[model samples]
Each structure stands twice: as C-alpha cells, then as structure tokens.
Target chain A: MNDGLMIEVENLTKRYSGHAAVSNISFTVRRGEIVGLLGPNGAGKSTTMRILACYLPATSGTVRVAGLDVYEHSEEVRRRIGYMPENNPLHYDMRVREYLKFRARLKGLSRRRSRERVDVVMEQCDLTHVSRRIIGQLSKGYRQRVGLADALVHEPELIILDEPTIGLDPHQIRAVRQLIKSLACDHTVLISTHILPEAEMTCNRMVIMYEGSILAADSPDNLQRFMSGHSQILAEIAAPLEELNECWAQMPEVEQFDVSPAEGAYHRCALTPRDGLDLRPRIYELARQRGWLLRELTRNRHSLEDIYVQVTRPEEEEES
Target chain B: MQAYLTLTRRELSGYFLSMTGYIIIAAALFLMGLSFVVLLEKLQLEPTLMPVTELFYITPFFWLILLLSTPVITMRLFALEKFSGTFETLMTAPVSDREVVLAKFTAALVFYMIMWLPLLGCLLIVRHYTNDPSAFDLGAVGSTFLGILLLGCLFLSLGCCASAMTRSQVTAAMISLVFGATLFLVGVLSSQLPLRPSWQTQVLAALSFFEQMHDFARGVIDTRAVVLYLSATLFFLFLTLRIVESRRWK
Candidate 1:
C-alpha cells in the first residue's frame, strides 16, 4: 500500500484497430497533487486519463487508482475517482441541483448525504445562483461549472478533468483554473490540456506527452532547468557586423552566434555555448576587451511552450 | 437495487422532462382516439358482430400505432446521450453496464405503456356515450392488455437495441422502424406463403403479433406467444448490454 499515492500506471498502451493511439508509457500521480498531462491534440493525454479513470482499458498495462487495480477492481477505483470528460458533456435538460443530486446518488451517497454534498459542491463551484435553472438554459461557463460540480459532488479522492476549460470564456477559464488549483489541498487532480500556460500556471507538475508517448515529466521550473542547455543568450553589440564576426571567430569561448541588424547601428547577436553554460559574464568581459560597446545582455531560458514543441516535434515528424 | 432504481428514475425523468415524451404521448392519444371514432362508425354499420373491446386489438390500428410509437419513444434513449456527449458521464457513474441497459430498457417500457394509457379513457368514453356495457368483455380486455405489454416489451427492446448501435437519433429511428416494419409485415404476409406442414403454421402463428393480439382479445392466452415475446425481449436487451460494454474496450 503506497501511502498517499492516488494513481500508478505502468507501461500503459492503448491501440485501436491495429493503430497505436497510446504507446507504452509510465507515470504516477501522488495524493493531493495537481498533475497536468500536457500535449497537443491526438497526443493520447485523454487515453491515459481515461485508462486511469477506468473509462477505457489499457491495451497491455496496469493502472491502479486509489490503490485499486483498474482492470481487476475497476468498480472500487471508479468509486474513488471523479472523471469529467472532454467537452464537458452534460444532461442539458436537468437542472443544476437536480443533476448533481442524481450524480451523487449514482455514486452511492445516501439521500441525505447526497443532498448535503450537492449543496456544498454547488457553492464551491459557484453554481448556487443557477441551482434551479435548467442546464440547457445555462450558459457555457455555467454548464462547465455544472460538469465540475458533478465531478466534485461525489467527493472522490481523485478528480480527473479532461480539457475542462475547452469552450469557456477568458473569465470562466480563470475561474475554472482557480477552482482546479483550489482543489489541490484536498484532492489529487490529473488535468489534461493542450494549452501550455494553463498547465504551467495550474499544475504542480506536468507529464509532457506527444504522439502516444511520454517525453518528460517534472515541475514547470525543473523542466526549464532540465533543458537549460538549450538556453540562448542575446547580446546587442554596437559595432560593425564584420568586426563583431571577426572578433567572435578569434575567441574560442564564443561557439556559435547569429548576427542580425539591431536598432540604429547596433548589431544584435545571439550566442549559445556548446557546453550549455552561463556565457553572459564571459561575453560581457570579452565585449569590454574587444572595445565593443554592449547595450543589452539577457539569457533566454526555455518556457513550457519551447519544451513542449522541442520534445514533441521530432516524433510528430517521424510518425508522419 | 438502489443503483438500478436511481438509473431508472433518471432515465424516466430524461424522457418525461424532454419534449420527446410529451409529443409521443399526445400523438399516440390523438391517433388512438381517431381510431376509436372510426371503430364506432364501423360498429354503427355492422351492429351485432364485434365487441367494443375488439377495437383495441382486433384492428390494424393497434399494430399501426405500435409500429409508429415504438421507434419514436426509443430513438432518443441512448442517441441523445451520445449526441450530447453524456455517454461518458453516464457510463462512468460507478454502475454496471447491465444496470445502465436495464434502466434504459425499463424506462422506455414505462413510457410506451404511458402512451397507451390514455386509450383506456377511450373505453370509458365509449361506455358513457354508448349503451353497450354488455358488449365489452372484461376478460378479453385483461388478456389484450397483457399481450400489449409483452408486444411492447419486444418492440421497445428492439428500438433500444437499435438506438444503442448508433449516436444519431435519426439513424436509430430509421433502423428501428425498419426492424419493426419488417417483423409486422412478415407476420401479416405469413398467410400468403403456401404451407402444408403443421409446424410451419405453428411457427407463423408464433411470429404473428396480429394473430396473437386477436387471440388475446378473445381471452385465449397462448404460453408459446408469451414465451417468444419474453425471450426475444431478453435477447435484445442482452445484445444491448453487450454493445454498451463493448464501447469501453473497443
């Protein structure tokens, strides 16, 4: 019994009609942790989440949710997890409170308990005002909230949301993001999204996937630092292009740099070291020694987008 | 048992709360009332022949309404959930696939029964307006309703099975209509086929819902017809469960 562990997926693979939709991959989400499955469309993020939620069977792997085997004990796992599928499908004819009450009852909550949970979740998801309104009459944001409320009303140990903010407005997106972030203290959340910044801002850790494979998994900060070798330093040098090039070739410390026209007689050069070191100080001193006036020097570290594209692009090409 | 009740209630409400249920009910009552009026005029012409109770089962009107209402009542059972994308929410709700299928099947049956419920009002109107209390056979009425129940179970099960096979309601209705029409037509056309064997006639009699209703209207209960309808209903319901379960793995 791995204490405080919500999910453990090992060598998970899902194939459809001889075509692999989710290749062999392995990852785990600990208790009360907010983990994001970051990938583009058709990257199998939903497949992984579905397998963990016990909505789909893994082609040839094992997924245990809340310490129960997904295949062998799927009912137990399903009881412990709340799954909000993509597009936030809802029963539009049902009212907000009625739908949540039904979902609570369906999840095995007693009538009194279901009522209490429905009230609490309605308040938590900001659905108090529209509790009596039919779901079809509600706006998209409200419907999304209804979906979230439905997932949380069960009070499951783990909540899996697949693109919960797909069709929400900016305000609704922020509200949903804040709602998901607030869930971290009590619930383990596995969120799948293609939006890079949302994952970075909302998730405590990320499992980056591409083309049915997991490329990397780490915190947003650690991912940037882990791929720091790919970082580039930009220096605006006030000198002639040929002089900057000639001086650059003379120094072994400067490995490869691109020179472009800068603002009014200043030439911009981007320098990247082969060894992935902080070349800012060395380049500044070299600039002073070479009699070249430097205007701005900054390091461009990798963001989630850079890391996402960098990790997923090569495999996309290979599959094509 | 609680899970089954919850699902059945949800499904029942899904029909009642939507326009589909109301529209089908209203249409069925109107059509049955029209058929009642036509049967009354026919009785005026031929005074001492058929009982007033025979209008429900002994006429083609009964089979026509069954063929039309069964598909419409069941087309949206799973199709709307698939169209609106609630299959995920409904399927993952900590209930077995069998519970889900049974819930839907039972809900459709209840609504199908509701649609025919207003026809009883027609009988009361006929009793009040016409002085024909002696012409109504109480025993035949009970058996007729029993036959209607069994036949409804069979038709709604086929409709639910067709709806389960697709996400589009139109396609579901079309497939179910085709299946119901084929069965009804085959039963009606059974006599056209030249048959010498007693077993062939028995087989045709078993499949003929029209003849079955006629026998039931006269209070003659055939265990064979009852068994066939019950078994066929169970067979389609089992097929529906398989389809729902196959969706998870496939």
Candidate 2:
C-alpha cells in the first residue's frame, strides 16, 4: 500500500471451474520500474496481467494498484492503470485518429484535453501519418502502435503491455522495444514476453514463471550470476593436446575437461571448474609455464535464456 | 453525462458510416412501399385516392418483419467488441457499463428512426394526392408511429442483451430472432387453448407485441400498452448492463 509501490499482488489465485490457472502468485512492481513477466505459452502470464489490470478479479487474494484494493476500488485502480492486451483488440472500422479520440473521451478526458493527449500519443507511438487510415487496412505494426496509443491516451501511472511485439518483424520489434524503453522514464511498465532476448533488451527486472508459480525473480545481471556457476569455459591453445589434457586433469579444482581439434595448429578444450572457483588465473599460469600460445580463453557468458532454463530445469538435472 | 453523450455520438455516427445501416433501411422501405401498394390496389381505390390510414395499419407488420431481418445490426453492439478485442479497451476505460449499453441502444434507436422517415414521406405524398386529405386519421397515424418507436427500442434492447451473452455476431442474431419471434406469436398461439376469456386477455396482453401495437394503431393511446412497452425496454436494458458488468469477474 505504499505510494512507492505502483502494484502489489499478494497470494493471488485464479481458478477456472475446479482447476487453478494461477495459484498463489505474489509480486510487486515499484514506481518507475520496468518488469517483465517471463513464461512460455499457457504459463498464466496473461491471467496474472489481467488480474493486475483490473480486467479480471482474482478468486482469492488482494490486488492493490496505487494503494487501492482492486476489488473494492476498481474504478480508481482503472483510472491509474493502462492495459494493452495480447491480441491488440481494436475497432477496425474506425479511423486511427477517430478511435483515439473516442478512447480518450471514454477515459473521461475533456474535449480539449483529449485532443491534446491524442496528438501527443499519436506522435509518441509514431502513428501520426496513419491517423486517417482505417484500422483494418493498416499493417500489423501500425495496428500495434495504434493500440499503444490508445493505452497511453489517458496518461495513467502504470502501463501493462502483454506481448507487445508478438507478431512484428525485426525492424518493427526494434521500434516497439525502443518505444517501451522510452516509456520507462515517465511511467512504470509491466511487460510480458516469452522471448528471452526481448526481455533482456526491454525490461529492467524479470519474474520467471512455470506451472503457475514464480520460479525466480531478479535483475538480468543477477539471474545470469545465479546460473554462471554451472557455465562452461572454453580454451583454445597452441600446445601439445596431450600436455594440455594432463595439465587440466592434474588441477583438482577442474571438475571435468575435454580437448578437441580446433581450426589449425590449435586444440580446443572445454572445462568445468568446481563451484565458486575462478579458472582464468589457473589457466593463465599453466599456459605461461608450458610456453604455450593461448589463442582463445573465454568464459561463456550466461544469457537470460540459460538462466531461464536453469531455473525451470528439473531437480535431476540440477543435481547432475 | 459527457461520457455517455460522447459514446452515443460515436455509435450514432458509426451506423451511417457502415453499409449495414444503409442496407437495412433500404430493405425496410422497399417492403413497406410494396405492402402499401398492394393494400390500396386490393381495395379498388382510385389512383389519386389517399391511403395514409391504410399505410399506418400495414406499416407496423412490415416493420415487425424488418425488425427481425436486421437483428444483426444491434447484435454486433457488444458482440463485435468482444470478437474483435475492443471490449477490453472499453472495460479498462473510466466509462461505466451503463453508459456503454445505453449508448449502443440509443444508436440503434436513432438508426431505426432514420429508416422510418421514408415511410412518413410516403404518407405525406399520399396526403398531397388526395382531394379530401383531412379525412385521414392523423391521430391513428401518430399513435402508430409512437408504437413503432417503442417496438424498435424493445428489439434493440433485446438484441443488446443477446449480444452481451456471446462474442459471435451470428449466434447473437439468431438468439434475438428466436426470442423476438416467440414473443410476437405468443398471443395467437395462446388463443387456441381452452382458457377463460379473462385469462386469455391477460395472458395474450402480456405476451403479445402485435396486440399492444394494434391498440396504438386504433387511435387509442392505452397507458397500459405504453407501460408494457416501456417495461420490456427497461427490463432488457437492465439485463444487458448486468451482463456487461460480469465480464470483469471473468
């Protein structure tokens, strides 16, 4: 209920018929933060987003937006949050500008204020040129921009976008990512995406969900760090393959190592070190002592995808 | 009030901008004009004879059929939003469910009026061609117009309710038509039963739209009939509002 917390959802659960779509999920989004809800298809991302947007009520839990409970003060919560659904719902028969104007009026803006806000959003979403075009005739990219424009027309405190770049080309995806990044300076945003690279580029923090429960929640860097211990290190050297293998095997800290043929006059070895060990200094000392030519020595950086896989992977694999 | 007015205005304008409105109006006028011609010719009236009185009696039946013909017009009132994903946008807005339902109903009513205007013009033409136009019962004609307005409002409200139940336009239209046809035929179907006269009158009066409409076309503005039409309209409008409000829980 703090002012600094833009959204607070506690023990939220949604049940359809007798089955739970989302069970006991809890998260909070602070003011001016860009958080990503990361999950695959049917991971209850949309259900959670819908609950927070006040479009759907949770079966048993409390959702507070801007310090007001969503169930008791839905109208007030609605006034403070803007939502863009995954499907980009729109009245295709209406012209772009006309639709924005209608949406602005419906959001309770005055005539002059609505007009000004419409113009501002149109420009911000790069929809000014296609303002006169009917929505059905526009391309998918333009339709998405129009949807974003409508969401921002009322100038709410928090904006929730569900798969905003779902059906866009590379260029269009970049454009939307830029627009989302730009929004972070002025408004708090909660974006949901199954695309790991997209989340890495657009969001400041991420919550990974699996089977209707959050598996992990942290910043991108922190998530990578959490998975880095299990990452493999690759070293390419210009020394006798047998000597490199022997040196790596003798190092008790080296848990496992394998040497294979590299491009030319070089041998590539992948090494897994013990947990919490830094193999770079050890490898450097070994290469210097053997007067070996070190062509490539790199610690493979773990990506969001690797972190996601690690967090959601089964306990059997984790033990291995 | 401003939100209501703005939504209503947008809805009203949407009707004229689409081909559905034009097609419905054109078909209604064609049927009404044909019925008017047949009635006048069968009565063996002269070419110059005024048939305004006859027009009023026949127009309601044609309007009734026309009401069923384009039930889809209002069926898409909320169904299209749900189908096309616009309902999410509307629900997230500051406008209440009452405003959305009322705006859609008012838009359908205004379109119905535009459709009826051409028939009114035909009446004026008949008046112009007659030598004794004063003999025409203006009171009956006025009452019938009022009756059609009320009936149109009722049908629109019913269509809104059906639309709110589903996101498919075709399914919404079918539901409304089935319900409307049943309401219209109730009076005729009930008379075949061996019921007492008092009971028959009460049941038929309660069930029949045409019965109430006939009373209006006879130059008698029965307050009971007026109450029936208004009650039906308000009841369906309220039901539509409730259906829309329930979407938040889903």
DockQ of each: 0.56, 0.61
Displacement of residue A108 (Cα, Å) in model 1 is 1.5
TM-score of 2: 0.91
Q: Is the docking of candidate 2 incorrect, acceptable, medium or high quality?
A: medium
In model 2, the clashing pairs are none
TM-score of chain A of each: 0.88, 0.92
Q: On a 0 to 1 DockQ scale, where is model 2? A: 0.61
Using DockQ as the measure, which candidate wins? 2
Q: Give the least accurate 10-residue stretch of model 2 chain A, judged by summed lDDT.
A: A306-315
Q: Mind giving the per-residue lDDT tens digits that candidate 1 earns over B1-250?
A: 6778898999998878978888888888888888888877877787655556676565567888899999998898888898988888887778888888898899889888878878778877877777778555677677878888999999999999999999999999999999999999878877566776799776885688777777787778999889999999999999998888886663
lDDT for each residue of candidate 2 in A184-222, tens digit (9 for 90 to 100)? 998999999999999998888999987788999888888
Candidate 2, chain A: TM-score against the reference: 0.92
